[model samples]
Target chain A: MEGPPEIEKREFGVGEYGRKIARRHLSFEDERKLNEFLRTEAPFYISYSVGYFKFPSATPMENKVLLGSDLVFEFDADEVGLLSERDVWMCDSCGEAGFGYRLKCPKCGSSVRIEIFPDPEREEKLKEMVDALVKDFLLGDFGFGREDVSVNFSGNRGYHIHVRSEAVYELDKSARIELVEYVTGQAIEPQYMFGGVVPCGKDTPFLCVEGPSPSSAGWPGRMARSVLNALERGDRDLLLRAGLKRKDVDALLANRERYTGLIGRGRWPAPKMFPLEVWANIARLTAPLSGHAIDTQTSADIHRLIRLPDTIHGTTGLVARRVKDLSSFNPYRDAVALPSKEVTVRVRIAPEFELGKRTFGPFRDEILQLPLYVAYYLIGRGVAEWSLDSTE
Target chain B: MEVFYEVPFLAVLEKRKDLLPENPSNPPESVLKAASTHLRSILYGKSRPKPVHPSVFFTEANLVAFSPSSFLWERFARHYALLAVPAFERREEILLRHYPPSEVLSLKEFLSVQRPFPELKLYHLEVSGGKVYLGRRAPLFQASLLYRDILRWISERVRNIVVSGSLDDLRETAQRVLAPPSGRKRGYPHIQRLLNVTGLPDGRKRVLFYWLIPYWVTVEGKTPEEVLELANEWISRQGGAKIYSSWILSEAENVRSKGIKPWSVRKVEQIDPELVKLLRGMGAL
Candidate 1:
């Protein structure tokens, strides 16, 4: 073990009912204690801090000497801005039902309560975010190797990408903020990213400056490639969203083949037509295309609690599974590892949630035969209880 | 009561500087909204201008802002130029202290280094009674002519663009602007060694100010006027620092009055984190 594994909390958070634990220091011996807690308390929610401390049982957050921490990046599908079509909503008043996101029923004109379901589409979008973080941002832009990084499903609506490296372990809070700034592209000066002004040689009429290209390092490189990608694909919507004037958009596309050739080679043919402002606008707009939309505050919070990996998330009854092939990994198939024997459950109101190969529920006020895995998930959510005629 | 960092409602005034009421009696809605966002970013959620707490407060995380209301505005106004005037923008709310041109010049430079919006050309409030001109759009025009040649020369060196076309431009520009007052041209060796143009003037120019000011005062027995004049003459020779000529004098006064320092190695990031890089590059902190 790399020194005694120190933790800030024992078994705190919502796990306890109406009680707050005083500052308690804990050591690595808590691994045994952790298992003991898992066996005894059956904590609905368990969370641990991202970084490590010097002394075992690194508690009383202020006093513990911090050794280092892993760079943790989180992604939630709901936060990713993808609307879930899988959410089921029903008006209890008229028994009118609908699918997708809805606040009220159109049939009976009654307010409907939505039961959010596990969306594979949103999860797939989340996987893309993970790919962007690990591949594009970390390995490609930041130059971290695959060996330095790891990825796992949060076992619910998100995934956490942990970067364990010798370099990350030494960063202080200020340095961590800088890292957040770099990855997130917040408050970055455009001139600094790509050299703003050029020297005045033989007094020319207008302004002239070297252009950005894909090969350039850091933010400039990301922007350069994005601009080049737009040029290559002749993407009008992208340039339009970048706040480019319609004429400039038309002009770039008209000479799309030529701009693509130069930009692809990382050269800007700085002619009088395409000036710096247009490029600056495009750079600002496209820069976010390369940024990871993780919670800006969490990465820098040294005391922030994150879900412990490989543990069963109480609501989903799915393990916060370590993903090997993220592209194909689904929580239902990959994360679920429970008794497969069929059991009966008396469910109140439950949305169709994924269990293995199939989805079950939207089972309102009924007795249903469910596999133990499905039964556990519903039971954990408190929407279902063991049936009187139950067979385990 | 002594406050820690103290400018909140005032820090908002600093940000919405252009919108500052010519009279600090009533600032507009735009200014107030900005102030609310600035306070809310730190106090409520995660945003920046990370709360600069008062020294009295034990909270190290910058949770508390220095209260401008807590301090004597009349006295504080003399020290730092850009300030949020009382509950409203009133002339009497401030004692209307008439400062010399040097003190007035120090305001923008001093304020730029402290919270919210730190743009140097952010505001240039000129009051007739106060007889003080705050800031102008000049990291270039103030640094006109001979000093520009100095900048060209240093920029040429920083860029490592060996002579030929640019060198001829440098030489021609230098010939027109280069002039020093006669008699003992004793040559500033201390200044000469530390002269760096490896990068353009951003925030790092603070180091040059910190280093150059002391030499004019302590090393050479120059009066404040002479110190300001000598600074304009010597630092102007660099070419890039013309815009900061006024800032140079302002900092020169600040250095003398307040013991503002040329960072020491022992000091370890005491002021202007940007300068630490250049100062270290210069080998003397």
Candidate 2:
């Protein structure tokens, strides 16, 4: 029942496989022709695939090779891959001549995968912050020159600032951490406390410093006078008769937020009524001991406190001297509670923006920096358009 | 006509996946033994007439063998299209004038020479079936004409075998020597089995072979030994050279022991550099 099957023979006579397409293999004559052609063509953006590291700004097409119709390797966007065989080279260090995204080293034949991708949004923010920091503080603070600094997008989010400065490169880990904290104006590690000053006389550091206990430290006049007067009365009964309740006195002695807010704001309604009790509590809290607080509120007297030099741990140093109210501006208690405390204000600033295929910044800048807090706010506000860009 | 038995089982095995022979009990029990006598003749340089089977037949086993997709694509370009063309259907213009318009059009279409690819358009030249078609600068053209090369290799191998006429003489001499000592051997069934009309026709063999080769190489998963043995058997039966066969056997052994086979994309801690060089040489990497 089977019909006769036909068989045809195809034979290439001679000299047919002469076309070489790899850019790496092109002769001088071929290069001239290709250059001429490319000169007339418009260049589009090229997106290549790199497993570990990003390509060096441009496609190094001169070192490239192609596997015939099996793989079309060219300058990234110059070829649209409809053909079954084409692999994009995003990084020069990790392609066929090195460790391709597949994890095999082409030269040494090692199994390694590299990390190279640009983080768009993070790079932008880091660039913004670094530029501001550099422009404001200059590289001297980090022991670096402008030329020694380089910026790279981490290929997902966040930008990495590589300071190749010889001064910074040699610094020990502790110094580097200190410098980073100073430049970023954030809390340093090994201690999680913030710094600020209690308002006092216009010229006083105690007027702005708050931490440990500031009231007990012979923190200067007007502020210290009202505080010490409360303390000098011989008996608690006499101090109480003058003004503050024993409980309020105890709270002030404990350096509680409520007591700090009251004194820092100068809204002590009963300062005269319980003069002795108030001064007594303030005197006890502000006493500073040998490198640590002996008296509760007294040790908080210093505007800046650190276990090491140039490493201030609390909020007392960062705030401007003119900011007399440490009580309300403390980020820990007030700024955080603001949104819930002022829901109307929260709803007003909830608007977001879309820029160049990414969305960010409907929330306040502080909210965006906190790890879990940003995620929580993002989800709570129904903001899915943005994602976190981490540096570490 | 004679090919129905020997040369065509590969394609048939591919089509009827269920009917494939299981691996015989242990090493040395070759599935290639089914076509051993024919294979021996091929290796020893004996011209075979129309085979009892197609030279490379479909097999169900092949359907289960796995190969890289790129490798499969190469095989398709190299083998399937050209072999499937009709033999007797020759255009007088093409045969005599050698620059037939139809052939030029088909070649242009197949190579996609006029397509928008910058490299393809800039580099490739069409010269209407000539010697300049197979040089170093024109790998695409050469690859496209692989069917021609395979067909030519087969025909030349067959001619050499036929001119020697050793298989025909060997069979005759073996018949006389291996004839049964008793005259009663003459009573045994002497007729070769004829084709039964109840199954798939032979005309569909070429199409079936094309589909099966890729499926076997790319989809049908096979252990390294099995794949190497199969490829070895296939190449040898097609009158492939000893160097190619020996290389395949050695490479299969290397992959088995190391687990980091050459021309393979599987990740492993270590791979032999020589294997990579070999693959590159074969243009398989």
Best by lDDT: 1
For A1-392, candidate 1 gives per-residue lDDT tens digits of 01113443222232332222222243334566666656776666566656676553545665666667777777766555566776666687887665677777888888876655677766776677678667766776455668778787886668888777766666656555555555555444544333233432345443335445576545555667778778787889878877677998898899888677666654564545665555555655665423446765677776665666777676667888778888888877888868788888887667666778887766778898888888877666455688988553
The sequence of per-residue lDDT tens digits that candidate 2 reaches over residues B126-238 is 12221112111233322223222223333463422222122333233223322222223332111111111112222222211222222233234355456556654554443
User: Chain A alone, model 1, TM-score?
Assistant: 0.78
True contacts kept of 2: 0.00
lDDT of 1 by residue, B1-285 (tens): 111222334566555568856644454667656765664454435433433321111012212212232223213332222333333222232223222223333221322221211322211222111122332212111212112233444455433333223323444333322322111255544344565433333433554555666556544435577876765555455554544557766766665554343444345366556556755565533
Off by over 4 Å in 1: A1-26, A56-59, A88-98, A102-115, A186-188, A196-208, A265-292, A343-353, A361-365, A379-392, B1-285
What DockQ, on C-alphas, does every prediction get? Answer: 0.02, 0.00
For A23-104, candidate 2 gives per-residue lDDT tens digits of 2111212334333533553111111111111111123432232211100001111111111111112223433321114445
- In model 1, the number of clashes is 20
Worst 10 residues of 2 chain A by lDDT: A3-12
lDDT, model 2, position B84: 32
